[model samples]
Target: MSYKILAVNPGSTSTKIAVYEDEKELFSESIVHSDEELKKYQKVTDEFDMRKETILNSMNKHGVKEKDLSAVVGRGGQLVNIHAGGYLVTQDMKEKLVDASTIEHASNLGALIADAIAAPLGIPSYIYDAVGSDEMKDIAKITGMPEIVRESFCHVLNSKAMARKVAAKAGKSYQEMNFIVAHLGGGISVSAHERGRIVDAIPSDGGPFSPERSGSIPLNYIVDMCYSGKYCKREMTKKITGMGGIKAYLGTSSCLEVEKMIEAGNTQAKEIFEAEAYQIAKGIGELSPVLKGKIDAIILTGGVAHSKMLTDWITDYVSFIAPVVVMPGENELESLAAGALRILKGEEQADPYKK
Candidate 1:
């Protein structure tokens, strides 16, 4: 009854592939694409063949037989809003991913590469917990401005996976537990999971500033800065995301480096690091009301969650809401495989991709 699965996760500069037999990982490989190499492609989708080839070669090197794989699961990409779950990789989904007008992201290549490899083998290819999955209530979308509506754009894959993991550890099903998962990484996403669905979330843009993102900023200040002619649209966008937060404050983005600076008695670094932790705690607090104070556990995950200094600071601030369980690392590949396995084992049904 064991099933072999191949999970593909494409990031901005790397393609991570893994093979799992049931719940056990056989091998995992991360294929790094340098800036010079990636610059040859005008669009992210254009690198499909190259990425797919590299993945196949890695699998071959790892002694994985293509025909033996029961299913191929990929990290979901930017598409129209959909629910959080596994979806069969269909032609319609591929079309949406390649649409030129939509945002270009490296993740869009996941399904394409997966389908290319799985289709000839006559096996199903699926995308689990896609980036565009939105399960928020309509009320949560409201904003003070009529033109702007909040959208659910948190780290859906990792957050939901951690929620399920915590639920399992507590001897409960994910559908029977309520949890708030804070994914603290380069960007931070604090999500409120009610029952089995993510009811609401503080997406990286709307939540606390992280190591590389500005998160929520004063609108008036942003407007003034935009009109002030000191920067252009692209520069402003980078400031709000890539070049903001800790890097903007102290000239580096590595949490480890920041912690070292604090140990070296750098007052400014310590203050900025504490502020990041404070904002994360505030974001977690904001989602508590969304779950009605009935949260079973507050899970801390993602790369930055590995930092004891940061986690301890956050735990000290929000321990009253619920017990904080720090489960670090992204673990995206395993999550993708598990999602597909649930569907394959008939424990959960795979959702269809609409639009």
Candidate 2:
């Protein structure tokens, strides 16, 4: 049986839309939104109509009719923490998507766009592997201080997808293996997948420094900086996640540019690049104990995983823990479609988001 699914993924500056018939993709497009164009909206939620119109236009241009769609799936945004799986979009979920306090990301627009298009046709809208999906164990929640607790806000959609892929390649079920999957991208997330459940995660904003995010910083120094009056709260927040990492040190977030500089004998560039690998390896080491060092495989994925130079550095340090698997780039759009298809085929059950 064939099912037609539309997957919508909104990013910081672009919206990715794809149409899939069962497992095969009919067509996909990434609509780029310029910084200046996005500047017109005060919040990411404000651009909902603009993004929805763009998606409809793209679908019309591609001859994708609403009547042919079996369902519309979207990239999950931050909501109340729930299990990892496809969720039927509800009115409560839509409300949380537009709540800035819940999550202030372009991805929040994903469900809104999907619902607007799907609702008129009476087709169900769903979201799979939401970023806020939390499966962390109780012990992993404590953070030494009573006031703060760790959140499982990593790249759940991509990390979990890679885990299943690697498990399949190993001729084993994901439920039968323990693995540490690192999603190295614009923002980095390293997580421990125990058996089939993600028991721990080093969220992108708090884990190893990535292309643009600062990762973990010295607590005392950050406190001092907050009181220093040199930067406001908004600026400070941007500094930690956007203007941090290599962008903060060498003034560029492009890993390819850093590699070019390293090839030209730029010692500072090479050192900082290696430093990032070092931090990533350290994160892997930290999570090894979470699985009691019984990790089956260490999978590396995402756009940054395309760089062998960086991957090599990370591999050299963590190879002893487990064999490394490098799966480059993200398959989020296809993953979303596949997830929705699974529910359609009764291969997997869709989980509900309880308000």
Candidate 3:
């Protein structure tokens, strides 16, 4: 029997679908959704229905239908302490699917799409390496109050990229070595991988902020800002992400734009830009102890990791502990697809999907 695996990713304005047959990609398309139609959705949960319908319609245009799918996989939303791996779809994952408090990530609908369409075709719906999947152990969950770990983190897509780049150079599989991979992307996440499993991590909560994320901040600063009446708590809280970090100061998120000013000899731009990269480097440095110098490589992966100046700076400073391997850009889609194969082959166990 020919098993067709469908990978769906929901973006804010579009839903991307990739059909794969085992390791081979058959077709890929991005279905665009208009903002006006999306705005009509009273709840974020409606996006699941909207996107499902959109994908169904798009598949029809190509003469395919929901029944053709054998296995459905997709990007998942954030959930606490989820271990990375393929997971069997269940009702538990569905509840969080509709929860709109964390993020309205279009990718969240991947699992839902799989859920709705897979049964009719006798296919299983699965989530591949979702953002919620945290391979980190209990120790990494610290945020403060002995219970809280004042830390930050990125995601699997970023860490795996770094791990692969470094592992190849190290002449070993990423699974064979213990490493601390820090993903400096829209949001930063660092993980301590013991052999193959992530044993610890610094979550973005109460940790350092990033260019797109206010990584972590002390409550006192937040309380002070609130009591001082200079900033609104609700507004400031939002500022810790979307408008915080580089966007807060520069009104732009593109590192390319910042580097242009640096090249033109803008001192202030140079300082702030350099400082941001430095903070990421500094974050990587903190993870050194977690690996206890047994760290094989310092893997930098993300859109930001491509910065020549930033990579060089990290290499210069972090070289003493381990060599740096930089894998710029994100191949999250491919990674997600690959993970599904791992699960199907029984190479990895099916984990419980959060959302």
Candidate 4:
């Protein structure tokens, strides 16, 4: 029997919904909500109700009823360090993804969107590989100082895709290859994948800031910044996650603009962009020993992976370990749907992404 699936990837401002009948898409919509409309709600939790209701309105406008749905799926959120894949959803998962204390990322609202619509209709809602999607080896997990903190990382989606593609070229499965995958978008994530899992990664909260993220700041410095009568937890959230990074340095988020400036002989832009790419290259270098020098590929993925300039930069430096492969563009929608297919086929046991 064919089933109609309603999949969602709700972000901080926009909500994207895709309805599919088996392998064919029936309906798709992207709701680019106004900031004013979004800001009307005082808190991120408040926005949850608004976004869910909006998606409902969208479905209804298209004459799609919740009762007619087959499966429900949404993005995963509230995870700090996680690998990426389709994680099936459950009630226990819900509590883990939502935190009144910690502000929500765009992904946080994924479950809420599904819960608002699917539960009433009695449809099963699944979170396909919300985070924590790859496998890392035992030793990669042990590159630690022992005690106090162990480095754990996720956001393994594109990286895994990259590994699979390169592995096929070498007549190997992803599990049989050792690779370092770097996802360079607004935020940068570098991970080491061995035997099909990402066991080691650099956490944004751990270090290396990105275009919009603050990356890792020293604890003592953060404490001083907090007490200097200049910042609050709220302000810090905006700075670190939103207004900081490349924009903090250059007043814009467009890498296109940054590249333009660099081409026009803007030394500072060249310096920052090169520095960011160099740091990512170095991130791959750091993961080599973890792979025990069995590196087969260095992968570049994410939005910034589309940048020829950036990919070439990383390739030039990281080529010493292995030939670099670039998987261009953000495939979150296809990725989301691909995950649902994996679960439906029983290739993966659904472990819904919760809070």
Instruction: List the candidates ranked by TM-score, beginning with the highest.
Output: 1, 2, 3, 4
Q: lDDT values of the candidates?
A: 0.93, 0.91, 0.71, 0.75
If scored against the real structure, what TM-score would every candidate get?
0.98, 0.97, 0.86, 0.84
Stronger candidate by TM-score (2 vs 4): 2
Q: Could you tell me how far off, in angstroms, the CA of residue 95 lies in candidate 3 after the best superposition?
A: 2.7
Q: Mind sharing the TM-score for model 4?
A: 0.84
lDDT of 4 by residue, 311-353 (tens): 8988888898987888876566565666676677677766544
Give the per-residue lDDT of model 3 (tens digit) for 1-355.
Answer: 4556777777778787877777687767878888888898876567777788777777777776677666777776555456666787788888776665656666667777778878677777788666666666556666448765532235775576457557767788878887777676667776777787666666554344566677667678877888887777778877886788777877777888888878998887777777766766677778778777798777777778888887787678778877777778766656666677667777778766534
**Tens-digit lDDT string for candidate 1 (93-163):** 88888998667899988888889999999999999998778899999999999999888888999999999
Highest lDDT: which candidate? 1
Once model 2 is optimally superposed onto the true structure by TM-score, how far is the C-alpha of residue 181 displaced, in angstroms?
A: 0.5
What lDDT would candidate 2 get against the real structure? 0.91
lDDT of each residue in 40-115, candidate 2, tens digit only: 9998888988999898899999999989999999998877567889888888888877765786888888888888
- Alpha carbon lDDT of residue 109, candidate 2? 80
Off by over 4 Å in 2: none
Clashes of 1: 0
